[model samples]
Target: MLQLEQFEVRERKLQFIKEYDVEKIHQAKLIVDTDISSSVSLIELAHMVGLNDFKLKKGFKEIYGTTVYNYLYELRMQEAKKRLLNSSQPYYLMI
Candidate 1:
């Protein structure tokens, strides 16, 4: 019975960590999406979203299947391509 109680406590702790990691990853993604042009460092982002750098990096990659920098770069590139194809503005202005 004591062992079973200890196991239950361990499971609860693991569940809490998992939920917290998910929340942090979601916030990180939001920050990335909201300001892709901003040159924020990963450490800074981690601090902003209340996560340590290593956990933030690992959790972000786990949740999104890409590194934060790569995700932002992909988003920027896609947006640029969309604008180039659809906008009437000059090419230089788009850049």
Candidate 2:
């Protein structure tokens, strides 16, 4: 039927969009990890990845099992620990 064919086409288009959005979500995570020193907000990240905040948040959580802020916070804390222990502290002192 003509209606069935049209529905299939529309569904395929929606699937394409969903795939693109997933790629953007991964890109957003990479951006955050690559620039851990810079303070990037949720809206900024969504804009950078060509997604809206709601989709970014939802997709990111679905894929990564955590919110963006929590992920960023964990990375920042780990980076801070690395820098603090490796910069001035003696090798033995670090351990």
Model 2 Cα lDDT, one tens digit per residue, 1-95: 99788767666545645788979999999999999878878999999999999999887776676899999999989987887766876656654
lDDT of 1 by residue, 1-95 (tens): 99788767666544645787779879989998998889999999999999899988877766566799899999999988998999998999865
Roughly what TM-score does model 1 have, to 2 decimal places? Answer: 0.76
TM-score for each predicted model, relative to the true structure? 0.76, 0.71
RMSD of 2: 9.9
lDDT of 1 at 88: 92
| Residue 49 of model 1, lDDT score | 91
**Model 1: lDDT of residue 1:** 100
Q: What RMSD does each model have against the real structure? A: 8.9, 9.9
Candidate 1 segments whose C-alpha is farther than 4 A from its true place: 1-17
Q: How does model 2 score by TM-score?
A: 0.71
lDDT of 2 at 11: 62
Candidate 1 Cα lDDT to native: 0.84
